[model samples]
Target: MKGFMLMFMGIGHLYEAFAGVHILQYMYGCSRDDETEQTERFGQLGYNGENFLEYDMKTLTWKSRKQQAHFMQDEWNSDISRLDFWKNYFSQTCIDCLKKQVDKGKSTLMKTVPPSVSLLQKTPFSPVTCHATGFYPRGVTVFWQKDGQDPHEDVENGETLPNDDGTFQKSTHLTVTPEEWKNNKYQCVVQVTGIKEVFIKVLTESEIQTNWEDPAPNIILIIGGVVALLLVVVGVVVGVVIWKKKSKKGFVPASTSDTDSDNSGKGVQKT
Candidate 1:
């Protein structure tokens, strides 16, 4: 059976430069238990954070919380029109609004979605992270089991986080060495709320997604590439130095008369 609580609150504040601040707070709500079919309605008023009055549904009267507030209770209770309005609003109008809201959001409130699980490791020696994402209802359990038994040691659980799409995600980490996991059977288990099927992933080298890669295979190639690049760079620098030196040695300053144009309208040309 599904149970729900619906509440409505109204607050008003009057501020005066000399008078400071006066606040009026009204809170009314209804809650229902689906299994018992029990419903309860409540309403209260507060002033300056202190309880001022409470509504008695049976007596249809405002109960004063403070001795000083009795005058207000008397004034409000004598107003038959206001009393009638509240009686109808709480009994009918509030219930109607709650029903409409529940009906409108029934699909989202009732829906359950399963999560996609993954095993991630940042490095070979780092902890194996069990990640579950894109699940709905936000209630899920993620854990690691070793040799078909749950291990409390070296296990860390993370808080559930909400996704932008209204779904949820959670993660758990299992810290174990390669030799330990290799000898024992390790698995990641994910159980989402409202779903009966349990999701499990066996811990294996092939199953782990990691950014770490064995550099032994490419070490020689990488070193050779780096050496070749350094050689090319050095050769280029040497060539540039030689070219600059030769240019400086070959460079000659032009004389003023050689740069001057002849009277024949023919510009002086370099030979």
Candidate 2:
């Protein structure tokens, strides 16, 4: 199934409580057997949510179709609209685009790489995540299991979302208590179409690493060490400068009269 809409809005034009030019909408659907379905081609001319033209591939006819040319009110007029012509045009265009996309897809092989599974315990609850990425043909199933049995009622299944690298990823979360952490067994299981085997892993605390663990303490320690070294160097320099200044101004004790008398007595006795 495919759909396309092209709207042309004149300046200051308003429709459906919005200002815009609504024009040229197209949609198409195709399958392995084209005969099995109807309403394959549908389009709307205005923004009023009314079907402009719809074609049934089974009956190959147009029913209750309306057409609106540029800046014109919608009216049911198939005589001048030529529904068959537009139907063939949209069908051909869609089929050609589909073929091109299919060819491009065929060039790349479809494969499934098992997800990297991890278990996390965050205070009140524990969550197990299975990141299955870089796989083609996006259909995948990821779920959780308790002990050796199927998923329990308490399990929460997350939606399968696309990744930036054109692959798909999904996570299944299960809440656990502290008691459950020590006593219960939990695992995350992954299954994809291309791979025949199912991937399974038991949840473990060792497998989970918190990305938010702070490095501020280590950084502060490094800064403190640097500051302490600078302080020690400054203290040593200041002490050495003061000691040198005191040594330059030497302390000489005053010579007293007693020393002179002793010297004179010794000289006179020798004479």
Candidate 3:
């Protein structure tokens, strides 16, 4: 079935090149009922973003969406060997492959994955967001509880969203003053389908994670760094000045004494 789909796509591309069509789209898939063991197959062809042809598996014929596509439809339907291949593939080959894939991934498809819950807040005054992510099966309930009971007011629930890893995430927001939550015992609860464990996060100042940072500490660090750098610069300058003074004091007197002795010897020669 997969091979046939690939071959059909290759043919479509070739047709697009010769027919001067900008785009050609081919969609084909199958669905099955687990209990009834019944399967249904469907296929469609699009030309330049418009429906051009459809396949009717029951009648074993192609249906033209537009009058201009009738010739192409007839041409495809007249190929007996292609029609036979489709009939056999849709009925047997596709079902067999689907069942094999399902069996190969049975553990992943049937197993339940638990979510990681977190309490997030942008600021102290903003609403507290209870985030639960990386759970499987998509059915999850997230809410806030106050003093061991569900809170009806000041709560907002968000829709479940899918992650790139095939897991799901959900969030619930609780809007309350800091004093209100601090005074009451507030908690976020996550209940995932097919799992017996209930995840809970108690609301507290320490537990609520925030992106906000205190500027006072950073400012103090900056000031300390500047003072340290200035001290280093001053120490370098002082060391250089002291070395120059020592060099001048040690060498200047000796050179002056030698010059005076040379002048006295010249005076003696003149006498």
Candidate 4:
């Protein structure tokens, strides 16, 4: 990112020297990274990515922090951290710059339109927000949708922002449904009066899955039932065989005693 910034600064200087113009641009990360550059107009700032030196308010002066810090401590302040610090600084700056531009751009667009204009940010998924802005947009309205479909569930919402030039800015948050967004194209449509509407579509978060899984439990239950049925059949067969064997082994002595008693009594009566 530092390299990217320096490259822009160099270009800005060249443009300023040749174009005789000073472009008013922002210093996004430089202000946040080190206070020194924030105070110094050593280089021309960029708008989006490219730098037009003529637009620079500082005549596109390019200054290196290490070379310009008044005190030795300030010169090496960036070195106090590790190499990763520089890497992080650049990434953070890029992200900040990108977000700021989008947000600012959105706000600027809202103020220029008429009243009660409903600008729909179209996407393949849900919109993050619904915000619209205009000069007298008291009657102006904002609406958002996913591929012209009504939002099915929760969606992130955007707000309408008025720009400095009497224009309006509004951003719609389109949530990327992993299932749908990949194959879909989302757009933000700015519907306005006396002007061609605009469209801005941004990628959103992917849909999440909360369903449960696992088929083993049912299979295990089926196996256990089959095993229990087999055990029951085997147990009944074994019990029947044991009872039959015991009945055959018994049934003896009681018969002999009964026969002797009856005979003896009959003889005595006859004598």
- Compute the lDDT of residue 100 as modeled in candidate 4: 64
Q: Per-residue lDDT tens digits of candidate 3, residues 73-111?
A: 999999999888878877788777877777787777667
Which one wins on lDDT?
A: 1
lDDT of 3 at 55: 88
What TM-score, computed on C-alpha atoms, does each candidate reach?
0.70, 0.52, 0.57, 0.23
lDDT of 1 by residue, 1-271 (tens): 1776789899999698998989999998887666886777888999989999999989978999999789999999999999998898778887777778778998887789999999999998999999999998888999999999999999999999999999999999999999999999999999988788999999999999998888886998899999999999999999999999898877588656743645544765868
Candidates by TM-score, descending order: 1, 3, 2, 4
Cα lDDT of all candidates, in order?
A: 0.89, 0.59, 0.85, 0.45
lDDT, candidate 4, at 189: 43
Clashing pairs in 3: none
Mark the regions of model 2 whose C-alpha exceeds 4 Å error after superposition.
1-26, 33-59, 63-101, 108-114, 121-130, 150-156, 211-255, 267-271
Task: Give every collision pair in model 1.
Answer: none
- Top candidate on TM-score is 1
The residue ranges of model 1 lying beyond 4 angstroms of the native Cα positions read 16-19, 144-156, 183-187, 223-271
Residue 3 lDDT (model 2):
27
**What's the residue-level lDDT of 172 in candidate 1?**
95
